[model samples]
Target: MTTDMKQVYAYPDALTEVEMRYCPGCTHGTAHRLVAEVIDELGIKDRTVTLATVGCSVYAYEYFDTDAVQCSHGRAPAVATGIKRVQPDTIVFAYQGDGDLASIGMAEIVHAAARGENFTVIFLNNAVYGMTQGQMAPTTLLGQKTTTSPRGRTAPEAGFPIRVCELLDTLDGPAFLAREALSTPPHVRNAKRAIKRAFETQVAGLGFSLVELLSTCPTWWGMTPLEAIKHVDEQMTKCYPIAVFRDRLAAQEGEQSAESAPGEGE
Candidate 1:
């Protein structure tokens, strides 16, 4: 079917019972809604096991209705590995922030991608570390000022933002990989597709799948929600291009078809 033909519905059963505590203009709420919608759409709510990593998203467990687990700073991937290994049929997913994924839990993420473990990862890259008082995160853009980088992020001292999609694409184990954003309506549509695609990959018994979402932190960034989305479109997309990196599972199917093609004589 064409991409335009796909329809998305509201997830009634997956709605959060508690009010959100995120700052105004924060895209976490949008990201959470997309994930919950994906879970409901895929019909994996009961069978799903979610891992909420430390950082601004620590309260993810409280929002998502599925069986959720809270892990230490940046340990969601490791926890997901254990859960999926023990319960192979369960749909396992890890929701983590850039600080948790690219900084403290870098080792875990790299190894998980390298091992091609069967799980889905929803990585939220909000530039600065929102939960820890606006510190510079691994995905903070150049010249972006944070509480830690008061004079803007200097290349000589802070280094460049790690492009998670490009970093993980170099690894051989991931069956599917993509980068997305939750800024605008079109972006939200793409983000939903990317997220669902990741889960669908795991459900098919393929290897690891990850969709890194370039999100917004209005409170930390000192902007309104609308401004934050505008900023992400203007600044963030330049650093992290939204696109698919790998589709090994799909490629393998194509290869099999090519090999089984009829001979010219037949």
Candidate 2:
């Protein structure tokens, strides 16, 4: 907060905006910073191509100063796939929400992973769909109330929340799959690392990469900023575990080392 104080780090130049449009206490701002930081760290802001999806956070392109294209609801991954395929040298990524990924964009993501596209995906799972009002999303936990389900999501009708990392890890294409949160100090640090790893994987020419982030929705959840962070750690962590579901890059490195001659390990 002082000029004499050396800044350990700062936001990406690509994200030069006046605060954000997200609700106070919402995790989208943190998530945006994480993505922007990665772009800045890797020096890929110019080459990066971000796909913004429909949702409360659809205006992400306005904040991210890189080349970004807006996509329809639940179609970010599909659009990103084409973009990366055409411009293999470009760093392509998709920013999606629970409603965009777990619910409507499920098929697109599954296929993209199966095909092993070289791109990154940032999935923000906030339980409820915050865009078109608070609706119970596919990632919504059982007994979690939303505008669509005032009585809470019943298992009989809503089924269980979809764990995107766990599901995508089961595929052969996904080179990196991790789930992290921005609820706590430690969690935020871990989340930033995971996001960086995701981008690094793509840069390494590894297949599909996805980082599922557990975020806070203060407005939709009807909680204050401080209370929302606590809820993310307590309630959200239960549904989405914090861990790397898969890492094909490590596996490949191991395999290459094993195949190399003796004393050639890098």
* Best model per TM-score: 2
The CA lDDT of each predicted structure is: 0.90, 0.89
The regions of model 1 sitting more than 4 angstroms off are 1-11, 252-266
Q: Clash pairs of candidate 1?
A: 25-225
- Candidate closest to the true structure, highest lDDT: 1
Give the Cα error of residue 54 in candidate 2, in Å.
0.4
For model 2, the stretches where C-alpha displacement exceeds 4 angstroms are 1-4, 255-266
Candidate 2 per-residue lDDT, tens place, 1-266, comes to 67789977765687976568988788899999989988998999999988889997799888899898999988888898889878898999999999998888889999998888999999998998897888899998889899988999998887888998888877888889999999989999999999999899999999799998999888888889899889889988987888998887888888888899798756
Clashing pairs in 2: 14-65
Provide backbone clash counts, one per model: 1, 1
